[model samples]
Target: MATATTHGARDHARAQEGNRADAMPVVPASAWPDPPCAAGHLVWAETVAGGGSTHRVLARGTELRLTDLTGDACAHLLLFAADRPWERLNTADTVKVQWNAYLGEHRLLLSGQGRVLASVTADTSGRHDALCGTSTLVRNSRRYGDGSPQSGSPAGRELFKLAAAKNGLSARDLPPSLSFFQGVTVREDGTLEFTGSVGPGGSVTLRAEQDVTVLLANVPHPLDPRTAYVSGPLEVLAWRAAPTAPGDPLWEATPEGRRAFLNTAGFLASRGIA
Candidate 1:
């Protein structure tokens, strides 16, 4: 005996109540993994500003987490053997040895000497660019006009030079660096295209296999088409991690991964490190 209009009005009221329930605030969860070490036992932690840089010496078994505090950020990174600075990350070698152009979780970052420098144990931002190198002053000036370290428009290359100098390196020592969180794809015609792939709270964790010097620059990707030179802050956290064991994700990722781990283990054994 209820009219159709009355039923319609009741339904509408119910829908409105549902919408209000859905809009209620919920606590946000962390995108990063819990610290490998106990709480308050981190070796170091810092937040690098946009267009800024940092350098550090990471010992073997050290776990470093890089988090994009905001979305659409790029971190240009380079690595070198602390003892032998000449041996550094080789992008071509890493790509060729892995038999893949895409770098994500479980990929080993190899040095030019065919040894493992670091292993990507976990990655939320699945895509990283290794083809296009870091941006240079000349390239930045041509794209964004007035690319000068003094003007606070420091390019990735300039940042690396300054970071390296602090560790007794020179401009000539700079090598091609890996740009994290910047997605690059291969087109049908063999051309490379850049795309946005990371969002706020996305992160990547790297576990060092050898004593290495890490250089990082928070800068825009060379292929970033944005007219504004906006970069975002990145949070870095380092801690001691447990030793890698057999059947680990990184160890069983590929045959090459196992081989690289063996090589690194041999190197460490020679140095009297377990």
Candidate 2:
């Protein structure tokens, strides 16, 4: 049998030196005190490559911002209450109760129990989706030839599963996700139109309404009509901020939104969180 270790053996010493990261992997909170997050002290920061994944446990009042560095990134996000993992994102109820499919600033992400898991505080990327979640392994393989995690075009579901497993979750705990940087609109005829990102540098910030575990898969939108796998990188940043107040304007924005906020407040109060 032939062995292929000759080159690697000669370059072992050099490999470690060259393998070091070219730049800071994470941007500190004080690195940039910019708009959107100008007031808060950032607590977490990361950049998930295309087809990659990540997870975060955010405390209530922490705001997370996801950016599509390039115009092709898609963010599939799943949320679970940190204290009670069983309570998770319920998109159907989010859309049904809100009476809207498209999402933007001031929109609340509701859980099955009618609690506001998170709320969109800022959104520069107008394109988002309540329909057509993220891509799956079967679909990725059918389209790109290989959907394995090691492949060039990995499935969003598999990436999510990997992220979830790190936080002690499993496939059964997985539910449909809410996608960002990509969108879908239903016409009067009941057909679907997929919308890609408006442009590069688009971002959406979500404020945790409760202490929550957030799982993110930065992959292509399943509905993207493109034949090639051309997604871009995703930037995840979180900063410390105050949660909603009882008399805040968002709480009174709509009858439905107010009810969701009230439910969230009740849960917090019961836990003696004041």
Cand. 2 Cα-lDDT = 0.87
Q: Once superposed on the true structure, which residue ranges of model 2 sit more than 4 Å away at CA?
A: 1-40
lDDT of 1 by residue, 88-172 (tens): 9999999999998888888889998888999888899876898998889998888778566655667999889999999999998
Worst 10 residues of 2 by lDDT: 18-27
C-alpha TM-score for every candidate: 0.84, 0.89
Give per-residue CA lDDT, model 2, range 86-190, as digits (tens).
999999999999999989999999999999999998899999998887888899999999888889999989998888899899989998999999878899999
Off by over 4 Å in 1: 1-36
State the C-alpha lDDT per candidate.
0.82, 0.87
Q: What is the C-alpha RMSD of each candidate to the true structure, in Å?
A: 14.4, 3.8
